[model samples]
Target: MNRPVFMDFERRWAISGLEDLTGHAGEAVLPKRDFLARLDELSGRVEELGERFGVALGLDHSVFMGRAAILGLTRRGQTSCNGTCRLIESGDGWLAVNLARPEDVDLVPAWLCRKGDDPWKAIGKTARRCSTADLIERAAMLGMPVAAIPFSRHPGEGRDPDLSSQTRRLSRLDPGLRQDDGLEGGRRPVVVDLSSLWAGPLCGHLLTRIGCRVIKVESTTRPDGARFGPATFFEELHNGQEFVTVDFATPDRLRDLILSADVVIEGSRPRALRQLGIDRDEVMSQRPSMTWVSITAHGRDDARVGFGDDAAAAAGLLAWDRAGRPVFVGDAIADPIAGLTAAEGAMASLLEGGGHTIDVSLSGAAAWVADAPEIASW
Candidate 1:
C-alpha cells in the first residue's frame, strides 16, 4: 500500500486556492502563518491511519477550502472570512467576538449594558471601555462565543522557544485498553455522532468515509446549527450519513443509541450531556472498548465558551496584516482543523482497541499548529 505525501507543490496549490477563496475585494491577503503546513500535518496523520487500515485516503487542501467555496465566503481583514466574527480592541487587549446566531445579536444590549441599532458598533464601543478579561468572562457566562487574544508578535520577530512546550493539543483522558480488548479485527465500527456544527460532524464524516457506519443524532429541540447555514455546505459535510432525532427530555433512546456504538463523537461542554442523562464516565465504564471523542472550545475540564473564530483567536492564530494589525486567517479555521484532529485521534484510539476519551479542543488544536517553528517565517 502506498502512503500519502503532502508535497510542496500541493501545499502551494492549496494556499493559492485558499487565498483566492478568502481574498478581500479581489486582493489576496495571505495569513501570517503557513496554514497549509498545518493542514498537511493533520491530513498526513489521517492518511497514515488509512494506510494502516489498508484503505486508500486521498485527502488534500480541498478539505480546508470546501466550506468557503460552498458558502462563497471571503476574508474581511479584522472580521472573520465568514463575517460573523470580529476582532475588537478592548481596553487592555484584543478580543474576538462571534455573533453568529440571532440570539447573540439580541444579547448585545445585555452584554454591553447599553443598546444600539448596530450590535457590532455597540460591542466595539463597549469593548473599548472594558478590559479583555471582563468582556470574555461576561461573554462566556452568557454562552457567547468570545475570547481574548492570547499572544501576538511582530512580522520579523523570532518564534517563542518556550511556547511549544506550554500547551498540548490532544490529551488522553483515560488509560488505554489492551490491543485485543476491543472490537474484533475486520469488523466495521459503528459511530454514534451526538455532535453538531462543524467540528464533531466533520470528524464523523471523515470516519464515515473511512468505512465506519456514522449515525448523526440531533436533539428534537436543538438541531445542528449548521442546518441554518448554507444548504450546500451542510450537504457537503453530511451527504450520506444517517441522521436521527430524539427528545432530550426522554433520553433513554439517546442513551441506548450511544451505548450501542463502538465510537461516540460529541461537541458539547462537559455538563451538557450529563444533564441529558448521558454520563461519559459511566458509558465508558460499561463499554470499556468504546472510543469517546470529546470536542470542546477549551478542554473537558474548562467551562469557557468558544467557537471556531474566537477559539482560534484565543490560540493566537490570527494573521498580521501589513499595518501590523491582527486579522482572522480563514473562515472559522479552527473548526476544520479540530475536526480533522478529532478524527485522527478517534482512529488512533480505535486502532489501539478503543477504551479512551480523546479530548481535542478548538483553541488547543489551533495552538498546536500555530506553535510550529516553521510558521514563524511565514
Candidate 2:
C-alpha cells in the first residue's frame, strides 16, 4: 500500500480545495463547474475504496457503490450533504445567496466519516479489537484519513498526560473509583450546564444519567447560537432532546439557582457568568463548596472568540487547509471535551477535600491527544 503517497496526495487534495477560496473576492463566487470538478475527484477516490471494502465484506458491489456516490455528492456542494465542507461562502457571499434559492449554492470538500454504529460502542469495540495499523488500513480501505482524523481533545482539557499523570498519582485508587460513586447518601447533586449544542447537552445528559439534577440556563438577551442559527439548531437530528431551561435574568433567580447547584459547567467565555450577574466568586462565596467550570473555543482567559470549528482547526483536532482554512471536527470537540472535563472536575471536586474552580478551554483540550506520545487514547 502506498500509504505515504496516498496520504500526501489526499492532504494536498483536501487543502487545495479549501485554499481555492482564500482569495475569493467579496463579489466573486465559486463557479459551479470548478466546484463539481473538485467534487468528482474526491468522489472517485471514495467510490473506488468503497468498492474494495464492499468486496471484502462480500456485499453487493452496487450497494456500496450507491452509498459511496451518495456520500460523495453530499460531501460536495449539496445542502443535505454531510461529512465536511470547507470554505463555505461567508460574509456577503453567504448573505447574498438566498436560502430559498438552493441552486446558487457552492461547497468545498470536507472529510466526513459516518459510523456504521454508535460511536461510543465503536470506541469500546475498537479498543483491544484492532491495532492502530490495522485500523488505519481499514480506514484507508473505507476512504477515511485515519491519521488526519483527530482523536484527542485540547491539551489538559480532560484526560491528557497531565490528567493521566494526576490520575496515576492517585494510583492508590487504581481500579477503585466507580463510574457512579455519588449515588448514595442523598448526594443532592447540582449541574449548572452553560453548554449548548449537541456535545454540551450530551455531557449534561450523561450527568443526568448518573442521577445529577441538571439545570440548563439560557436567555433571549444573549441567545445560544443553536437557538438562532438554523444549521446549529436543526442541521443535526439530535437537537430535539429536552433540557431544563432557565433565563439568565434577575439576580435573585440566578442566586436561587446558584445556591442550589453543586457544580456549574459553562460553555462560554470566561467572565461570561459575571456579565450575566452570576459571578464565580460570588457564587462560590454563597456556597463555599460549589464547583465552577467554564468552557470556550480558546482557553477561557485568552482574548479570542474560539468558535468550535475554528478552534478545532487551529488545535489540529480537525483538518485545516494549507492556507489555514478550517475543516470542523466531525464531533463538536469543545462541547464534549468541555462537558467531559467539567464532569470530571465535578467528580474530582466532589471527591475533593474542598470546593474549587476549573476552566476547560476547547483549544487546550483539543491539543491533549497528540502532545503526549506514549499515552494512546486517540
Tell me, what's the RMSD of every candidate? 5.1, 18.2
- What local distance difference test score does each model get? 0.78, 0.41
lDDT of 2 at 362: 57
Evaluate candidate 1 by giving its C-alpha RMSD to the native, one decimal.
5.1
Candidate 1: C-alpha lDDT: 0.78
- Name the runs in model 1 displaced over 4 angstroms: 1-16, 21-27, 152-166, 169-185, 374-378
Lowest summed lDDT across 10 adjacent residues in model 2 is found at 92-101
- Residues 117-231, model 1: lDDT tens digits: 9999899788888877678778878888887776534433423222332255564423234334323366889999988889998899888877788899999999998899889
TM-score of 1: 0.87
Q: How well does candidate 2 score on lDDT at residue 225?
A: 51
Using TM-score, give the best candidate's number: 1
